[model samples]
Target: MWLLLALVLLLVILALEMLRFVRNMRTIPGPLPLPLLGNAHLFLGLTPAEACLRMGELAEKHGDTFGLFLGPSYSVMLFNPRDVERVLSSTQLLTKSEEYSFLGRWLNEGLLVSNGRKWHRRRKIITPAFHFRILEQYVEIFDRQSLRLVEELKLRRSRGHAGVNLGEAIHLCTLDAICETAMGVSLNAQTNVDSEYVQAVKTISMVLHKRMFNILYRFDLTYMLTPLARAEKKALNVLHQFTEKIIVQRREELIRSGKEQEASTKEDVDDVGAKRKMAFLDILLQSTIDERPLNNLDIREEVDTFMFEGHDTTSSALMFFFYNIATHPEAQQKCFEEVMSVVGQDKSTPVTYELLNKLHYVDLCVKETLRMYPSVPLLGRKVLEDCEINGKLIPAGTNIGISPLYLGRREELFSEPNSFKPERFDVVTTAEKLNPYAYIPFSAGPRNCIGQKFAMLEIKAIVANVLRHYAVDFVGDTSKPPVLIAELILRTKDPLMFKLRERVY
Candidate 1:
């Protein structure tokens, strides 16, 4: 009789839980979810590339805004620009969603993941590092790296105009450029493609993507038992050690040169007789918040954040730009003409800040590419307070997802949204009157990407340099789009191939 009573009590508890779930489901429209698992079954075993496609399909069926449960977490996907702005523009919703906690082991409380007071403090300290004057100093590094990339392409073409994976090559070039500009260290990653640090960065990104989609890996105890976790541990060691070494070396160098004291007072500019300007790391070393200087850990976290954000996102954008320009011959030619006009037909001439600014047509192409394929397809925030979107009440603590990827493709916003038309960005056209929140490839409002200007400059420098030295041609079917995956950034499931023909003056 006692055993029968215990069984009855268990059933009562489960019935109550089911009743609560049903009541919550009535408020939102989405696919019916299975108990306990929620919608995890739909995404299980799907690659990031496959997952993005699946999400798009669901969006088509469920409309612009829908709700789903990812293992008890109520998530609302916002594809409408107005809905996205409602969440992103809120000061109360500034905290990143729980999914970002996965990155805390690597990024810590860096500018990308921190919230509230910590975020404000770091943002204030780091904003000066990207000032126009400081970015001008970075232009030389961008030019040098671009030249190296062009040289690499030339060497490859000398053998034959064989199809080359420009995506991988551009990633290496960007990695090298960011390392030099952000850390004041030459990784030579463009030449040394198989470096350990490069491999570690790649490994960490893959592991993170895997953990994100696999619910089984979301729990700490379960994840720690997996082989992927072991690999992640090793990769973190490599990444942390690399950044820590750079931080220590930079600090020691400042102290040895007796510039440590001077750094705190002097303007962040190149020293009188120095050949190289101070890097982003140098600025961090001198920065303080609340009269307290940043410690070594703080310095490493920021450096790591900058290195990853600075390289990966820009490389992804450039990959899509290459694909767009290569497929659109007219646009490609127009960009080439604009580049040649700015640089005066000298392939060896370095790209200067002023010269980069003049490549107006090339900038349009980059912007168009970003519109079609934003590097960061989704941004997430935790709703800290109850909010209303499209007349629907979004309860506090709900996870809100904003997709720039979907917003950019809305027919109501852009005519021929699927087409690669650089002219859509012309200042004289109606595109100039479009809503600012509508075309937020770099996001919008207060929490937008701080490195957007730096990214654009780097992209323009490389694109101009490449077009001046080589005529890129598509090697595959131009009619079909590449299969895109939502990793930490946007990526292609397969290699994006292109043919580079040596340009004749």
Candidate 2:
């Protein structure tokens, strides 16, 4: 009788809580959700691309702002620029949503996932690593890796393939560049794309994506029971071991050279081959927060974070850029001509930061590519306190999603939003001013990407080198575009195919 009375009381409390949640969310227009399941059934077993499309369909059916229950979590997605600005611009709304917790195993409390005081401190420590002088030195690494990419593509074509998936090639190249720049070591991912380290990264990413959508796999206890958990564990071991090894090796090297002290005080350091550059690892190894030097674990988290963000996002941008320019021959010819004229006709010539800056037309095309396929399709934040966004009361504890993918395609924001028109970003010549919040490929406001300049420089280097060597053309049916999936970073369901012909100067 006592146990039965306790069970009844627990049930009553749950009912009251559910009723309060319903009262708060019902005012927000959205699809009528099923009890307990909420709107999860709509996304059940859907691919990331299909799920993204479903969200888009819902946005069209409802208005700019809508609500949904993702498992037990109530989320409100904001599409309008006003609502986006309110959330992104606020200092208090900096905490990442619960979904980011899934990355905790791989990234830990790095700059990407940390919040409040910790985020602020980490951000400060990492800021100097991207100093203009430091980024300028990384241009050499970009030039070298991008040339390697061109060589790899040529070698593949010589092997008698009619067309190759240019995306895979780009991925390997970016991975190589990031490893060198982030950790002061080379995985030679371009050469060994099938290495254990590479495969581990891929596996972890796949597992994380599936876990986000699968309700049963969301909890730690239940997730560990599944087969994916084993794969994830193996991958984590490989990744953690790799990063920890690099961190130890880098720290030891720095200490041995006695330049470790210099790195802490100065923005630059003497790297291998007499190159004056500081890899992010060097800075972290020497950095002190509150007068205490960062330990190995802290350093590894940031280095791992840098490795993931620095490579994948830039690789995504390049892949889509290649696809877009290949499909538009006029744009391709213009970009090629710009590279040849500004950087020189010699395909072997190294592209300098100055030359990359001179390729104004290519810059326009890169911006346009990001606009069409922003590397990060969705930006999410958890509301810490009750807030009013565009006259709507957004209750605390609500997960807020802002989709750059859909935001960039709004008819009101861009005329013919679907077309690949580089001229649209010609701010100097065009009279129509763009709303800053509407097109946030790199995002905007306080939590914007810190490595945007580094990414831009690397992208331009690839464009200059690749276009200097070959004339690229998309191989697939133009009408049937590759299915896009947003897995942390945006990617196609399959690698994008392209034909690369050596340019006759």
Candidate 3:
């Protein structure tokens, strides 16, 4: 009887091993993974992006696409440009990965992360909000606050210091831009970091970013399993309470305005400003598809999703932008020339759309930076049905990973893929070009970033304004760039520091 019981246990273990890789699955090909843990052991000393790069190198040698099982998190990573193009463009058989389980807790069914009908509806509803006419109206609002940073650094560089840490400053500028355009709130964080709302926004965002990777958060039975989870809960609670308070205040303000309107017109109707606090809330608050109205919690989810994705991606691009420009004085000088050429040696005047448009080289510089260090490091999807890629069978639940970071840097793709070269974007015709997928900083296909135009506009304005005022230089170690750490996006592990020098020109 004891022998029979042992036999049954052994059979169970064997069954689990068999399920690791479906042999009938076309097997794009990948390094063999250990049981239960799969390829997780490969990530022992690497960030997720670094690990993906390492895996990508292995895949290039072995095959264009390959499968990896990190625990039950199985996904085929597309290493070749061809494979990535197919997976990203063909959304029918592939859907967003289940790995985003953590991010989903806050997003609900927001446009950026939701699926199918809900995603379609939200996308349709929010499309009008970002219409060029509406977004163009906010560019001046972006420029107004960007000057605050240039002014702050002006004071810091008077003593012959190298540079001020610009990460937080840039974040402030973007925060103000997003706030004013979306929520109709006014904040100039470039000049003041101590603002209650700014601090709360930053703290809560930091806490959320820090929570996604805590393995202990995965366990339900263990309270003492991870202190990180507890801290995250506290942060989330505070953020929700804070957001609700703001929502309530906006509601009351709207109510009073509504009452005044009713008294004046002698008729009843919802307050235009009161019905929605800002564009961020307005997108969801005013949404309806065939009479399916979004609830307040639904509104909360969408607002938070926009708030997070809005500042984070732009901040990543800007940080890398400054770091790149600071290191390459030639590039920075060229950018200044480009800006001055457009603005005509003007220092006192603020940048406008026409002026921003004139800096074509600067636009190329931004594109090149994004190609090398894309804001979103890794994009993932899951196989909804058994699918074939590059003549290989990819099974369902397989997480397909692709990185613009690697594709953009491949020697086979770009001339000097690793080198900083803005001229790569100077091609006059779209036909005479590299695979568009090879340089997707804002991703590609139907689900690419909706706010990309808004982000680029803000970035160009800020860069032009900063150069018009001051020239950036590295104070300490220009020899070593910030080590890349992959979270929701690629971030510098340390605060990217450099010295700022006032341009005597």
Ranking of all candidate structures by their TM-score, best first:
2, 1, 3
Q: What is the lDDT of residue 301 in candidate 2?
A: 88
TM-score of each: 0.93, 0.94, 0.85
lDDT of 1 by residue, 171-206 (tens): 999999999988899999888878999999999888
**Candidate 1: deviation at residue 464, Å?**
0.9
For model 2, name the residue pairs that clash: none
RMSD per candidate (Å) reads 3.9, 3.2, 5.3
Q: Ten consecutive residues with minimal summed lDDT in candidate 3?
A: 261-270
Off by over 4 Å in 2: 1-21, 266-275
TM-score of candidate 1 on Cα atoms, chains taken together? 0.93
Put the candidates in lDDT order, highest first.
2, 1, 3
Model 3, span 353-399: residue lDDT tens: 66777788899889989988898888888787777887777776677
Error of 1 at 273 (Å): 12
